[model samples]
Target: MVQHVWSVNELGEWLAAVRIDPAIFDLRPDYCAGLMVVAGISSGPSDTDSDQWLQAADSCDIDLDDVHLEHWRDAYRSFGAKPNRTRPSADALSRRAEKNGLPRINKITDTYNAISVLQRIPIGVENLDAFVGPARLVRADGTEQFDTTNDGLGVAEHPEPGEPVWRDDTGVTCRRWNWRQTPRTAITDTTANALFIVDALGPDAHQRAAVAIDTLRTALATGTPSATRYIDTAD
Candidate 1:
C-alpha cells in the first residue's frame, strides 16, 4: 500500500493561469512495463538493456521522421519557439536514443524513456520531496533560476520569456514547456516519492495522454510495489 498523497489544488491553480489550453487526460493503466524504483539501485544501463533500448528506438525512427511528429512539433512551435531548437523532451530523447543509444539513468528513468519513445509524447517526472510547495505549470517571465548541468558542469539558466514551464515555490522544475527538466527536482536512486506529468498535443491528445499515463502508472508500480498512483485532468 502506498502512503502520502498530496493535494492537487496547486496544479489546478497553475493551469488556470496558463495561456495555452491543453487537453488534459487523467489515466490509470493496469500494468506498466517492468519499471521499478528502489533505494540504492544502480543507475547504470547494462548491455542487454542497451539493446532493448535500441530496439525501441528503431521502432519509432520512422514515425519520428515522418509527418506524424510534425503535427505536435508545429503546435509547440506555435508558441513562438523553434521545435527543433527546443523540441519536446520526448522527441529529443527518442532521436538521441536512436542515433547514440539511450542513457541508462536507472530503471525508473529508463522506463519512462522507453515509454516516451514508443508513445511519441513528452513526459516529465520529479522527485516530490525536492519540491518547496505545490507544483504549478505557468508561463515563464525569464527570472526563475533553473539548476542544470552543461558540459559536465553545474550551471544556472533561465527560461525564455512567454515559455510554458512547470514550477514550484523554489524555482522552475521544467523549462520550455516539456523540453527539459531542471536538476532541482530530478529523480535519483534515493528518490522515494515521484510525480509524473505527461504532455500530448493535436486532435487526439486526450486519448494519447491517457494511454501514456496508463503505461507510466504500470511501469511505476513495477519498481515500487507500495507505490500509489493517480491522475488529474484539467477541467
Candidate 2:
C-alpha cells in the first residue's frame, strides 16, 4: 500500500517530524534515542535468519549486573516507576531470554528484539501506517490515551502525569519510557513501512545507540528495500 509507494521526500518529512521534548532531557541528561524508518520491507513470520539471531541473543551472557540495565533501572526509578515490577524493554527481554527465550513475533519485530538484547538497548518497532501524526517523545500530562491489552482483552490506559512517553498525534505509543508498548501501532505481518525507536541511557548513551542503530540497519538490510535513520538525543 502506502509503504510500497514511499518516496525519498516522504521519508525525509517523516524523519524530520520526530522530536524529543527538552523537558525530558531535564530529567535524564544521558537519554539518547535513534529513530529509523524502513520502507518496502519484506515482513512476515520469523524465518531462519531471525530465529538464529534470536537464539544467539539468548545465548549471550547478560544479567541484571549489566551497566546498561542498571542505568535503565535508575531512569525508571527517577520517573517514579518500579523497575523491579516493570522492567525496561531490554532488561525484560534479556531476563526472558535467560528463562524461556524471546518469542518469535515477526520478521521486523524479531530482528529489533534480537538487536535490543544483544546491544543492551531498549528498542521498539511500529507500523508506520498506523500512526496518525508525527511521533514525539515527551513528558505526558496524563490526558493522552494509551490503547493496550489487559489480560487477553483490549483495554485503554493513560500514563501518569509527568511520565516519559512516546506518542503520535493520537496517543501514547509507549509508556514509562520503554517499559510497555501500546498495541494500537504494533507491527504486524503485513506491515511494510516501519518506525524503529532505539533507546540508550547513562554513560556512552549516544555511542551505544549509534551502535544499535548500525546493527539494526545491517540486520534489516535483507528485508528492506530502503532504510532511513535519524537519531535524536539530549544536549
Best model number under lDDT: 2
Against the hidden true structure, what lDDT does model 2 obtain?
Answer: 0.84
The collision pairs in model 1 are 32-218, 32-219, 36-223, 37-223
TM-scores, all models, native as reference: 0.72, 0.93
Q: CA RMSD for every model?
A: 7.0, 1.9
Q: Predicted candidate 1: what Cα RMSD to the true structure?
A: 7.0
Off by over 4 Å in 1: 1-54, 58-61, 66-68, 222-235
Can you write out model 2's per-residue Cα lDDT over 1-235, one digit (the tens) per residue?
3544666678778878788899888898788887777777778999998998899998998876899899999998888989999999999999998889999988888888988998888999888888888899999999999999878999889899999999999999999988888888888999878888888887688788888878877787734344455444543
TM-score of candidate 2 against the unseen true structure: 0.93
- Return the top candidate by TM-score: 2
Alpha carbon lDDT at 93, candidate 1: 80
Residue 15 of model 1, lDDT score: 29
